[model samples]
Target: MKKIPVLFILVLLLAFWGCSQKEKKVSVKKVGPIDPQMVQDQDDMTWEDYKPIPEISWADPSIKPKRGFKMALVAVDFPDQPFVITQPKGSDLFGNPQIDPIKREDVAQFYRDFFIKPSDVNHGQTINGYWMEQSRGEFGITEVDAYGPYQLPKNLWEYGLNEWGQNDFTPDGSKPKGRMERDVDSLWRAEYGDLRKNYDAILRIYASYDETGVWQEFGEMKFNSKEDIPPEWGNPNPDKPRWVATRYVPWTSWKAGAMQWGISSIRQGENSGTITHELGHYAFRIGDNNNNPYVEPYRRAGSGPWDMMDRGCFNGPGGPHKRWVVPAIAGASMPAGLMVRNRMKNDFLTEDDILRLSRDSLAVTGLAVANITARAVEPFEGEYAGVIVELDGEEPHDRTPVDDPAENPLSPGIPNYDYYSLEVVQRIGYDSYCPDNGVLLAKNRDKESRNGGVNQFNCFNWVIDAHPEDINMVDYDKPNGEKVMRTIADYRQLNDALFHAGLNSGSEFEYDDPYNRLHFYIIDLHRNQEGILSYTIGVKSLDGSGAAKRDFQLTAPKTTKESVALFTLKNKDKKAGLDASCFDNDIYRLAVSTEGEGLKAEILNELAVVSSGEEISIPVYFSEEDGEKSDVRITLTAVSESDPSKKMEASYVIP
Candidate 1:
């Protein structure tokens, strides 16, 4: 090669060095902390500063359909296939089991009777009740033209359908295709030729075999090969150890291309809840809300048993598994309905039905109250107008008071980053079986975050449990010993979760969001005779100051009898709190008192400042040191600022 110029030679040498330096720098770069500007200043914030913002956002579907939604029902069967038809067996506490068989005509008629009429076949009702109610009567399967029990040329497996325990058989690869796809195509070709145009959706159901159903095998069939069959199966006409009926569909999917909603197969006694769940996916395009417990590591419950989108729809005394019994004995075990967020997204809730509170609106002093309606039902004209309260701080709710990176193996990208959300969870219709009714307080990060390179809080919604882990609440543990961490699983926790306040108003639910930036205090909760839940939520700056300050007057003891010191605590704070708005309640603690070690104080009437004029009696028990009738002066105080000393006080004489 020709001799290189001196400058070129030097440049080549420098380039080699630079590559080495770049490799060294790679190990040092780390993601920067959350922007300071994004954090809200907690120093002077108060409830008065909070102005609610709209929480619900209706979905803007690009493909909006006409006013009403209609669907076509296609019942399919295979050629000469030995389809097992089941009838109710001996009646017992658990009801009946599938033991008898019917003809193809009977299977087709069974589906027809299920959709066209309301009968005991489906828990003494039809799917019309659930679909109509869930869609708020806006959607129904008005016209169901049943086709099929129509025979297909392929065997059950070739058609991409198989009975439970029969899935191990493989195809010849003569026609390589996805089993489910093949099944859908075959059904569509046979029954959906001219009728696809008349409906907004399509439901394809098959008779007999349950692919995912939980059933008991009565030893009618042999586990070995044909040649290895047992002597009990001497007459293999019907094949001994006949398969017990169970769910046939392994998974539910939307065939957008064919505009078809197909089921692998419908068992004899399925309910409307299951159908509605599939409809939720097909009609609304909403994803399942239930957590994947089978996953590794943090197998946390997805949305848990609260939302219809989650396992809560399977809510009943016996839980999800009990739902399999045909002619459902558990009544309607499906979830009450969708959560507040889903309702808003689906347009089931109008703007007027919600109350929106945002961080910007919280700068001034004011009290906001909302009588929220149950999200499951169609919200009345204005129910959605006032239920939202957002306290967005400069810092995310989860990121403050930073968690050490080393400790959080699943470090959610930003620490303590969250926004607070408060809503009322009421028991009505499907929600009737919910463990308890209360105002649900939750924190959410609408977006995803990664810590240590793994997704944490993937759903981004965390319903703050008033009691995170109390045996009396949710005691059941998974096989791996992981507890079912959800509010619905526990009895007492769900009950205590309600903001039902009184003097002994249970425990205070405290959430420290934005690290040292903001605090959410669920001061009190109340429910009306109409079953509307209202919560008094307080937002304060980390500095312990807010527009709504605690103000109360402590009157002298009614009588210093029985070594008990009594004083009346009243809500005299002119600022007022959330409870003051509508369904208001007050909570007070003995901030400071001279009664010291010499006495014990007990709040006799559950701690609640029900009305502004109402007084809460606080009784202080005298210790042996003070004696029963000692002339002493005690000053009772209430919270005002960071230090309870900033609050108001009163002197009482125990005579």
Candidate 2:
């Protein structure tokens, strides 16, 4: 080879050395500390400043279909194969289950007569309710289940679907139903004292509750299944188990009744009364008809703690179908037909239902209504690096809301905060909001920082370092500064549950709620991605029934002042802080409605204001109406200059 020129040779050597020194980039998911590119203050800041210009926008989606009514069919195909339907040898106090084994024909007709057919105007009786005729569900039921012998599955008891033994419980580990199928008729026999009583009460008060002129909401609540779920462990055919119960098709989607019609081991028990529970799903799609311990919201679950819809209510006397006060049972009342119907269909408050449940959506801040309100919040982005939760915080204890804004200081946005009987230093503590606020609350105790950039409070998650007893106390071994982190093992079980439902991702995942966390009724922490990640605290299905701690976050609330013709929000100081409106502070609880794809998304960010990294829950809300268009993504930028055009920016949206 020809000898290289001295200058060229030196250049080649230098180039080779530079290439050798370069290293390959390894990917890491950990979002690093604020990128310098995120910094806009190239020069130190003066106290006074104006915001940088932003692309102005705001829009809202109108005609977003109001909750509409829909239905799905779930007929109980009680054993398509032949089975000997029997009954218990005796009767109960109700005289309901003394006989058995009529023909499948009689069993099928009974349900159709009770739930599917028109009540013939009850002739002479004053029949009322939605006679104005709101569309009742289109009724249909599968043919009677194919008759078959009581073929017990080898592991029926182990699975607990069959209530043969006392140990047989719910799918999520609750006590098993104790109703024995007695007086075996051609179909089956078993007394449903409380369950039937509830059905009669519903029939007794149908018109008074819904004088809308519409017929029975569900003219037909059908059931379809093998009419039996063999216990995985103990006895083969355990009484008459309701196979198809109330359930929602998608999240709040077309809800319908389900049941296992005829085909049972007990006598006189096989009738449509059992099917009434499932028919509730169709009639109201708001809750189940029967307080089936096997269902999700069995007979005692509510954000208010317990109700007649939570699982394991058989333990409570008067549960398992038994009405409490002989008049109505449970508390001072029973659930009204309007309760589930209005709440689910129109997001309306059902006075009668609230009255029956001994609760009032119009009197107190009913949790169901509150949940509906809280769900209105929009998210910051598609997914998030982590979640922020606030379970309990500094609010006066014994807070009694009186529906009217005049009685309660917090409602109607007067003070926008409620009065509490707590210490002065303990008002609006961290547990009352999403945990993201806690990250900032850690510094609230600092006497030097009362108004360190954060002036007013929005949610409980904004305050941190509050072992104030006023805030929820959680067990934590160690913390990684932003969020607590110790054993990834402890969280694995939750991770697995979410994963199985296609809710979350990452094999070595980690998350913690040190404070049990606030649930803003966004119900699920779900995403529509491949891993189908979400957060679940055992509310096994999409139908509403359970508490979830994952749907919380501090939002950047709204304000009257907005940047004119610019895509930016103003700061309370009357001065501009992220000139480009980088720190818009507007945020919300993300929830996906059934009418739309699970377009709901969420993202949380902790900004280190100026130099101090204090936590704060800023308020922010957005709608297509809030911006010029729905496609406009809200961006947050930080800059020292009055103009943001010359600064770096980062953004998150409710995509």
Q: Which residue ranges in model 2 land beyond 4 Å of their true spot? A: 1-101, 118-335, 339-655
lDDT of 2 by residue, 1-655 (tens): 1222222232244344435544411111122111111111101111122111112100111111233222211112232111112223232211222244334334333332323222431111100111001112112221122212222222222222332222323333444332213211212212223232222112211000110010111211111122322232112234433232222211100110111111111111222222222333334333321111122221211111011111111111122223111111121111111212222243333232121211111112112211010111111132221221111233421122324322321121111221111000100111111111101110011011111111111111111111211112221222222322211111111111111111122111112222222112112123222212222111011122222111111223232111101123222222213322212221212221111222222222121111112233221222222223232344444332112232334333332
Against the true structure, what is every candidate's RMSD?
21.1, 27.6
The CA lDDT of each predicted structure is 0.42, 0.20
| Model 1 vs. true fold: TM | 0.62
Per-model TM against the reference: 0.62, 0.21
By summed lDDT, which 10 consecutive residues of candidate 2 come out lowest?
420-429
Candidate 1 lDDT over residue span 1-655, tens digit each? 1222222232344345446655331111111211001111111222232121123111112222234556666656555333334343633212343433455566656665665455554333344544555456555555555555655455544433233323332233233234443454466665446556677666666433332222211121112223332333222223322222223222221000011112423222232235655666676666554433322343334345566555555554355444444433342234445655555566655555666655544444333334444444444332342255454555443444444433432222344434556665555545545544555665544443333222233354445555554423233354345554433222223233433322333444445555435555544443344434444445544433335554566677654434445566676655434433542333444543555343333322222232455675554433334344344556666553332554556776543
